[model samples]
Target: MRGMTDLGPLSLSPVMKPADPPGEPLPGIIKTKVFKEEDYINMPWKNGLGGTKQIAIHPHTADFETEEFIWRLALSEVRDSCSFSVFPGYDIALLLLPEDERDGSASVKNTVHLRRGSLTSPVALHHNDQATAVPLRPLTPYTYSGEWPTSCKIRTGPMRHLTFIANRELTRVTATLETICLHGLHDDGECSDSDEAVHKAPGEVNGTKKDATGNGNGTALPLGDECKNPMNGNVNKLLIGNYSIVYVVSGAVRVTIEGTLEPHTVLAGQTLVCERDDDSSPTDLAMTPLRKDGRAFEKESEHQDATVLIIQVNILRPERRRHSSLSDVSSFSQARPRGRSGSIIVYDDQPLPPLAGIDGDTAASSAARAVAGPSSPTSTIPMRSWDSARHYKPPVFSSRFKNESEVPPAVVRDQLIIDEFPVGAISTVWINMVKQGLSEWLRIPVIVARGKEEGPVVGITAVVHGNELNGVPCIHRVISDIDVSTLKGTVVAVPCINVPGYLRYTREFSDGKDLNRMFPGSPTGTASQIYAYNIMEKVVGHFNYLIDLHTASFGRVNSYYVRSDMNDAASAAMAKLQQPQVILHNSGQDGALRSAAMTRNIKAITVEIGNPQQLQNQYVQWSYQGVMRILSWLNMFQLDPADLAPAAGPPSSTILCSKGYWIYTKTGGVLEVYPSVNTVVRKGDLIARIKNIFGNIVDEVYAPGSGVTIGRSSNPVAMAGDRVLHMGVIKREGEVLAREAKENY
Candidate 1:
């Protein structure tokens, strides 16, 4: 329980704290102990839901009022509070904001200020037309009970879209350009040089026909009779080779050769094949065109939306060949998905020169003059799901919380629960986890150990920055003297992950690595990466929940408290259980250990105690009890609520950071801050000031917002445009419940 002395008054801006001594940048990420609060501006309210504000609409009437040329934006002051809506227009966006009237209906106000080119929406009075107007009262609180309209209107620019017309009504067209097709991997059967006694099965070239002149020239040819078309037969398919496979996502086509009376349609349910062969028939083989006038071989516009696949085959021929092999016949290579074969292969109208056969036969030899027709095979390949590819294993020891027996009588009898516990009691546990070879020997130790009893495994780890000693001592005390034997479950602790930096009292490890930022460790990396990987994979990779502890460095100071992303259930539970002097929710940041842990489904929070290098007994006591309270909540131990004192002050309603901004000094100088964290400030309020080294006034920083300050710079000295403070604003509008649930007996 927090006593009167443990709590600090809440303010609008962060209290100025000290800075860390100048040091080298750590190789990895480090957690900063200072609390920073800043300002956030005109965030938007979309249908009562919070989101980015980018719309700007002009009201159709003059009754509503709103800020014009908005400037110097900031957060609101009242905690978790919202004010009246102030704009109006036709439909809702068409009117300016309004003011509440005694008659219970709101009166139209004025137009809102806006930046150029921003898109705006108009509320619709009726769904059928663009010009109808709706009363603005529905947009105000009393009428809608402070609820925003459920739907918003969208308006596009007044421009016409272009349309294109084709000379002919083509059955199908492909919008996206085809991907470049390179020669594919070679793994098919080899080719031979001489046609020497090569007899292909009759169907291999059956029903082949070629329309070389686009006049359906050879449609009367008999099955297996070589046609005059140059691109027919098993030979044409063989030329494409086995390595390349193509999927015709849509459209249809029929393949035929010189001697076929009918063409086979390569449509959705059909398969066609053309192959390369080494048959050395002396007479030149006739070839067939797969299509005529860009349409399927012999069919009309029947399967425009059909799709098919084309796979290339590899053919290796032997050495020694003749020039007849190259010519044989000419004309027709380009074919469209829906027939259309008018694309000429112009290099004098010839296909790519086939590779020299394995026997070194040049293009000059062994020409097979026979035209094989349309009898080819079709195939289908299965597709895989992308979601199933992202599955990952849960962390080690993934288990739910279990109830445990009460704390031992000896611990209660010894007054350990009542007397102020010492700091650093659990320090050795961290060291022991690493020292005992239980944790990965990385720059950041990710280990957590549970007590013997059946309580929750509260994460007690320190050195998010290797040098912060306050948590070190506080944890040491909890583990050393506390009767863990009576405690339920275990108190998982990691004393020093940055072992090298701790000895020097610096923020980074000796290798210039920071332990905090290197979360979700990499599988392959530098020493720091490996360490991070090992820790997460080994230590932290095993726990279900966590608590990362920190303190102000030698140069700074901070109020004792706990940080949480109250949006998370586990985090909220920890914050309430710890019962710190002040519970600051909305403290989440991406890439932090807490964020990473949460991403992996781990419950976690960051606890910040007192600042400065000094160890205050009360602060230490607060830390101890907070841990016990957490353990008690987890059923690791039991304690009397009656013995506990009321929290330091009325629990401030939880404020959310709808938006935030940073304030930097214009010139390097000495800085002084006015508003402190939790202190509410009015718009345009002065938040800080700057002075030269000689104490000459240089500039004064005013609040760009009207919300409470959650954090600020602790260092007094600053450079031109140096960050001097941070602010956040509450933009939520509606009834806010001020009650919170606590662990009850």
Candidate 2:
């Protein structure tokens, strides 16, 4: 009843609004069209397990993959039990239309997101709880996350149902059903096709309906045959909006746009669409049944008999959702739909921007965008649609792990190619990279400093995350200081692992993937996965030890630290030699290079430098000496005790933490975190405060336990679940815990 119709409950948690919308609507724009049943195109489902009748889909060229289509309406056929194809970032609605069978029904078995393709802890939506699931009842609409891996099981034989898919990031979607009564309409059954009119009358629309008297001989048919079903006497107006879909299940409907005298008649089995400019506010719609030229029929006066489905979709603008209200959402780990593997925890990476193209603003990125493969900004949509063939093509990505045949013929190590560098000399080895889906190779330069005497091969990797550039300079200094003649084993350094991301100034791979999280990737995987696989197989597999260097990404800062599996003797020793500000004793099994190298029996430790995208000379020099210490400890090189001193802020007695977790904001506001990078807090100390723009404090965060601040959000703007601080629960805050770091549990 409002400007835009109020919809029923939404399926997913609400997201923060953007500071501004893309643009306003074109002036005075409104378009209307009607499509008959014959217009629907039948297509096979994404899984190829079944088929569907696509009644309507925005951007018709959109394929099964990606979130290119804003909304889609389809009638799906479920013959055998099968899973629903994953559509990771879209809102989905479904309704089971009546089908023939005794005690007949179909139920969707599960809904859960992709957990590395392992299905666990399924939420059965057939009879799901009201809060989490849309109750499955005939003709009753229910909604769920399309990202979840869903499947259907039929109670009877083959089943048919309706599905509505919409990207809430692009537009808001809602549906309602109402009956159209036939009891009070003209008995003549006269519908104006303009051609069907027997007599030409005044006030007749060029292509609209309604104009005759009752033919007493005609029988009033309600819902086709009333004897086979039920009866009612209530008529409802169409719930059309800025973007609306009017699907009449029975009887003819007359659509009359305001300020227009002409009325168009849409017969049964027809869909009428009302569309307005994306930035324009919705207007009220006028609708009635098709009858002889007569007075408009009011909904309250007629008996409901036939049904019409109305779907109202409104593009969300910043003006609609911008507010200072706090949201209830769990931290990233808990927000995931299912359990993460026992050892793999992916909480180390930074949060994505609120929207792809935006700088910090009204919203912090939600867990969804943090996990989406790649997408358009949540606040903007494509200006063009599939009205014709000349529109933007949806993004596509594919790649495979490099095979031996893909490697370069020469200049190599481990027979993954040619002549290897001689011992006792520093050389640059160009590792061939397989271009995604192409035969050409992209060479990745690896610095290999082979020692005169063979010992353990230590691999140092930096810039796996494109923007974490502190590691780049840190690696350069470490390498330049070492002379191959005195060094023992071979030391290899990959200074810019994600070249594409580095070139693009992003934190991920060219395809918007985290190379650090791909691990020893698969032969059949995404672009990032393939590259990661090559790094592990052709390059890292030769190392006896691995050191992955990193730094904090945009909008955040970190203390110089070492992340290692302290339980492992070799890993612990490597971490200790760094003399960092903090040492995190984590399992390190999250798809990270540390854990990936561990799988191949390579002792690995991740040294996180401070800041990103630029070299911090002090930290670089400090960490470079740390690398010399590690080489000295490994008997690969000798180091002078004089070089043990750091060039940075603190003297090197490291704080050891058993584990770390982010203290998140429960509300979004202008935030101020109180601690410096390595500051230690007593339990219950004030850590961060969130204030509204008006300068009044709205929320305060306190340390739940004694811990060292490893990293904290630097941006003043914060959203619910945004990081306040990465608190490392200390085993010892000021001490390096010499005995414990050596061997004790």
Per-model C-alpha RMSD = 36.1, 24.9
Residue pairs in candidate 2 whose N, alpha carbon or C atoms collide under 3 angstroms: 112-148, 112-149, 211-292, 211-293, 212-292, 233-303, 233-304, 234-303, 234-304
Lowest lDDT sum, 10 consecutive residues, model 1, at 1-10
What lDDT does candidate 1 reach at residue 480? 38
Clashing pairs counted in every model: 131, 9
| Candidate 1 local distance difference test against the native | 0.37
Q: lDDT of all the models against the reference? A: 0.37, 0.60
How do the predictions measure up, each by TM-score? 0.38, 0.43
Q: What would the C-alpha RMSD of candidate 1 be, to one decimal place?
A: 36.1
- For candidate 1, write residues 565-669 as lDDT tens digits: 766776788877766644555444444566667777778877766554445544555665566677677776565453244542223354544445566777778
TM-score: which candidate is best?
2
Quote the positional error of residue 162 for candidate 2 in Å: 83
